[model samples]
Target: MALVVKYIVDGYHDLMDNKSDPRVNDWFLMSSPFYTLGICLGYVYIVKVLGPKFMESRKPFELKTLLIFYNLFQVIFSSWLFYESCVAGWLTHYSYRCQPVDYSRTPLAMRMVRGCWWYYISKFTEFLDTFFFVLRKKYDHVSTLHVIHHGVMPMSVWFGVKFTPGGHSTFFGFLNTFVHIIMYSYYLLAALGPRYQRYLWWKKYLTAIQMVQFILVMVHAFQLLFIDCNYPKAFVWWIGMHAVMFYFLFSNFYKETYNRNQARKEAKAAAAKAAALNGKPQNGVHQNGVEKNGSQKIGICFTSQTALYEHSSNTNGVKSVTNGYTSEETKTLRNRAFVPNGN
Candidate 1:
């Protein structure tokens, strides 16, 4: 752990000293292997081939404990990012962009470098987000949106560090970290259970906030694109994909989860009302029997033939209508005619 920390510290120092990036040298290190292993593990877990019984044992999700730790981690992580963005923004505004970048230049600037690395690390930490879902057996929540969001973020951030490392990305790093501060904080509380369930008013709005983040990211990235700056276009491509995918998936989710759902409910209600007025079963409904054991109701129950005749000239008669069997067939089938008890 000490050696690893020293290596990270050295990586930053090398970047500051204008030496070659240590990441290139460390590509085959033990930590690199672990990262690959973690990604493989994530793939297996997401695919549900990792074993269910093990995951099930972790269910009945203890929200309180989960959120407590989750928020605690958020506080520290977001705080650092908030500070990093502020410091980077400060230096870039003043004189850091065009200078040779001396080590003694600015206290805040060094902090920003550290923050850049911190932001890179935070992306991988977010893998825990999916781990929690898997453990909770909320596999349905793991959609294309979730997997793509989780997988690509860390990689993009790492590319951020390897390429541009600072500038407008700080704004994004800052805003996203800020959002995460609120988001993970909410998740933490939500995990605490029903006591906090009533407090989850902004659940839908979280996606809106994410969309806002992408807009902000697009705006900031275009800043470097317009002016002379060091941020990578490759990283921009990655970020662009993230934004586009988020928009598509989230919009679809909103449409399906809310709009289309309400439309379906309304259509069903209208059909039911029409059926009631016609004195017949609805298009897919039946009044005679309820759905039982996943089976649709037949609604073919027979009543006493004479009692049910629309205008009974003779109670003993049988007549089949265009829509259905006659009252007498119903009575005969039900054995509801002839016997005193049946009648």
Candidate 2:
């Protein structure tokens, strides 16, 4: 096992240390696979195992202020990263395609390199997301998808910075930072309190935003394969495939959550309509198999049959069904019930 570990570490060092742009070597954790692997494994063990276990005997921490500040910090951090990405890529030096890593000491290229490192480091900061969940005892929030997304990012992006930083591929980080700005803004608002709940109705749209981001990333990455860009085709393929995978995962989650919710709503509506037609109010099903007026029910009237009927008021002011059918309004009743009510 020690020999195997030694070989793997040596290989990682050789690939990262020798081949990586020298400009990025001084950047923190830029060429250190050991640090990246250690941080990720430590994050997993803490959040998934140790944190939960420790919290089992303790009360969940109400870190409301801490969370609010943390979210605010992320918003600021993401905004800075996004600005840097724009300035380095779009605003100045980028051609949008085949933009190879500028290993020279030019200001714009170095700025982009720094931006790439920042973006890579940002992935490590995201570990706090799971930590926050563990501290709050919101273990449900720490899902498999969430863990994988956070845990894999640092290691995956480390390569991007180490090898192909400040290239056409940098768009991934740029777009991601833009998305994070919005996402962290949402988190910030949500952390505020109940007062912001109304504005948070757009929470459902966040998933849509993520799907759009994934689509955009996939398109951008896939475009490289068709064009004759100098950018590494293998990296492009990897990014494109990664984006596609996330797109499908997020799509399934969206459908399972929102689509099922919608289906449930439709089913409830159908059930309510059936109940109303059968003279069974949804609020409460009477033991006597009769619909009583003044009982609040959802959307429609409850009637036993489509034929002639009468509703009479008892002394208690509750409307009860009677056998006698009133001659008046009979045609109107038939039109409302047996006939189609569509306009």
Candidate 3:
């Protein structure tokens, strides 16, 4: 294992040592529209075609022993990366000061020799994000935002390691590592059970942390872009695009999550009022089971059909985001049960 890591470390050092500006790499990746297009299209194919097939093969969302083991492995993987990053940072503080450190002659001079390989390897491991989602069969949750974020982050890190392996490299990985601490832990609990759902109320805030990470990445790149930080410009811009896209995508996410959702609920209320003359269109299932009041999955009458979605995990499951209803409102709707005698 140490020998494998040494070769990988040597590989990283040979490439990143000469890098003068991070933005050069950044532009190369961003300039090629195909890079972004290919990943997106690939995920699209996965979602539209492969996604259904994958879901069909597995049971939807059961916390079996395999998932338990996966979660445990995730903890180990993320924790190792986090520790390795700290070790790399400590070495980088000395190696890049005033003069660059030469690693060809001496092996120890390489920043946490094996740590860099761990860093690179962890990038590919992140692809498991989507695979697990597919395994768990949370199809509706697998939106474009989910796919792109999962797919791009790992590749971005791969390029970052390929171009610049140490020094300010620690900066990007550290923030991400810290976030992963919370993120992976959340996933661990989420995999275990819905009892952990309340703890996940701040899932949106995780995106907020991602936004902060990108902003900091931009700042790191800007320093290298202007002043005498010896990262690569091509590399800086290459990774910087990730930051910018993350900001725009996540900002839009926040609005869609918090702001746009409210506007939609208001619009829904107004439309509901206009249609209320026929009957107060309280959001609920009608007698015929077609969602007369609200277009929900379950019906007004709790027949055998309602049992499919009533457990709250099926088609008639929680519709909190789309129609822009809050958790509170969703709860109210679920409890009311849409009887014709009631509003």
Per-residue error for 251 in candidate 1, Å, reads 3.0
Candidate with the larger lDDT of 2 and 3: 2
Go through the candidates in order and give the C-alpha RMSD of each one to the true structure.
9.4, 8.7, 14.9
Q: Candidate 3, which ten residues in sequence have the lowest lDDT sum?
A: 96-105
Per-residue CA lDDT of model 3 for 1-343, tens digit only, reads 9999999988766555454223333443323334645765676577657877967865776545667677667777877777776665543443322222223323443544345546655655665566666767766667677777776765665554444555555566767777887777777777777777888887777878888888987776556666565545676677667778888888888888878878998999887776665564356533344464443353343434434334343334444544232223343344324333333
- Candidate 3 lDDT score relative to the true structure: 0.60
Predicted candidate 2 versus true structure: per-residue lDDT over 1-343, tens digit per residue: 9999999989877887787788878778865777998998888899889999999989999899998999999999999999999887776768765677677888888888888888888998899989989999999888777887888888888878888887877888888998899999999999999999888888778888989989988888888778897778878987887788888878887888799999999999998888777866575654333334454321222355533322332223222346322223323332112221222
Query: Which candidate number maximizes TM-score?
Result: 2
lDDT of each: 0.61, 0.78, 0.60
Q: After superposition, how far is residue 181 of candidate 2 from its true place, in Å?
A: 1.1
Going through the candidates in the order shown, the clash numbers are: 4, 0, 22
